[model samples]
Target: MAALRPCTLLLPVAALLFFCAAGFAVRFPDPPGAWLLSLAAVAAIAAPPLAALLRLFGPARWLAALALLSAFAFAVESLGVATGWPYGRFYYGEGLGPLLGGLVPYLLPVSYVPLVVGAVAAARHPRSRPLWTLRSAALLTLIDGVLDPGAALLGFWVWPGGGPYYGVPASNYLGWLLSGAVSSAVLVLLWPRGSPAPPALLDGTLLALAFWTGVAAFGGLALPAALGVALLAAFLARRAGIRGCARVTFLKKN
Candidate 1:
């Protein structure tokens, strides 16, 4: 077994702390408390993936990815809020902290970029960029499948039209699909030549799945909870398969 890095432990610890705090915060309504908790949650979720990206791709590439994705997310979100073309009409509440231009949250990219990085890193068959992009986009959508409902329940965002799934419109997911595809393409382009995604990259994604699964279950949203569990299972299975293959290769080499 490969030795675990000390930094790798930070993700699980942060996740657990956030999950516990979130559980309490959800039950008891405290505006100031919720705002602080939400900030903490964003940091906890985003830090690991950003670290992984830096470790894998170096600072220059990491910065590039971060800048580009942040701009893209803000633009798309602003457009969505104003025009409602892609993600449906959604308005943000004050819980997420200050809104940029009174439109989207300032911390949008901090949370958004990590999801794209983690999803692309978790994708199978990295050599095939097209397939990787498609799969990563789908994975992003699935992650949103868990996230939107829980966000709605928590009053992070409100979908005025309100669709079948926990007040989130279907158009929001379609927006995610499009956004995910574009984000995946950007990651693929920025990826270092002849380098595979680091295994540690998925840590952030796993933590997200675990946290959201708990949130969904706590909120009594069965479908989103199930989807979170299923996504976690699929990712874990993929990790296990990769490890098994590595072991076989090592034994053969020996």
Candidate 2:
């Protein structure tokens, strides 16, 4: 384990998510089990960035990304509490048996890891054509629209007070938009070299969510929307004079 420590540094998040998903499946039925296990997943996904950010402690970009992600998380959560819109239709039941603030449990937002990772992966995938770019953005915007409450039915995650808002309310799709835009934007700003492999953390989370929350809950709605956003992003980048913004996969050597 000690020898593997250094190797683990690059993808600490994926490792965490792998275990977490397993843990969630273990207890399988209890909400408390799901909540704690979900927190572990959050840690898993967050570990990589958190490690990098810690190394760059004083760098403006590091702090900025953290603040930006945190802000998006805060906004998505706060809005869910206030408007009962976004995420999905499920609601929290009295805040983790009173140990929590009776507000949303903090661990829940950790699930954003895989979603954010998905955005990052989409940005670099060879098949990430512009058509899906902009479309993805729109669909992601509405992903939480149905996902939040939909997941709740499977006992995946939930919001408080349990609304039936606009016939489709939860804190899900809102996070997708944030994850799609903000994560991509941050990666662009960071301009990392080489294409990144999709993180295992993302895969684990998706699998877990599928088991407990059921991935088909939202249909293909979010997928096309995300594609659309990405396409729009590609076009807008070209307009702003960013070279190859229209290109999803460059022909040049990596």
Candidate 3:
């Protein structure tokens, strides 16, 4: 608990920095230390949910989950880059950090896994794994709905054949749907039965949504911004409902 205190405190701060940096980048030229700030921010925001995973599932289980998901993300992304079947023909830019095997970002797992964990945590279904998986996949796809446009605008990646949504193709979202399903499935398969997803676990998804929301708004992409706002509202409302239920149960018991 003592060790986790700093991480818990750092999550929101890191998220705020990323949001500001992303918004600034879209609004103006890249600032000094932007890449470094981004790297640090990503690391910070990713730490808490990962810690939660380890705490909830144990190190072995969490590590296995991380490895499997990372490998899958890299393979799928590499395939997407090479063949353009799932995500459309897109190539990464220099902004997202070093490439893995010169094909995908090394930080891919670091950025991706936590989002999966957070989605599972946020999904409405608790007893039904199938419904949970579907809902989590949808959440992830919705996240990409906001994220892809802003990321493309920021030059994190490029789509040579741009589509209508801020240079992002519809196929990209279709790819996210497939990826999200597989990713959520991996999580549900490994997840401990009857284990509740703690509210703190939602930190990563919230951070991503908030950061992308600001980025999209700053970039003048109205739809993505609105989607981000809606997602945030839904998550917050769900969280409130859960807390309310918990309070009622506690009072009833008392």
Which candidate's lDDT is highest? 3
Rank candidates, TM-score, best first.
1, 3, 2
Predicted candidate 3 versus true structure: per-residue lDDT over 1-254, tens digit per residue: 22333323554565577678667778763567555656776776687678778877898998899999999999999999999979999998877778888878887888898889888888847678999999999899999999999988888889999998888999998999999999999999899998777665777777888888889988999999999989877865665554422211111232
Q: Write the per-residue lDDT of candidate 2 for residues 24-65, one digit (tens) a residue.
A: 443354555555544554564455434433333336665676
Residue pairs in candidate 1 whose N, alpha carbon or C atoms collide under 3 angstroms: none
Query: What is the model-wide C-alpha lDDT for candidate 2?
Result: 0.43
RMSD to the hidden true structure, all candidates: 5.0, 10.2, 5.4
Residue by residue across 33-120, what tens digits does model 1's lDDT show?
A: 6667677777767765677678668889888988899999999999998899799999888778789999999978877887898799
Q: Which stretches of candidate 2 lie over 4 Å from their true place?
A: 1-28, 31-34, 48-60, 85-90, 94-102, 125-150, 156-179, 190-254
All candidates: TM-score:
0.88, 0.49, 0.87
User: Candidate 1, overall lDDT?
Assistant: 0.78
Clash pairs, model 3 backbone? none
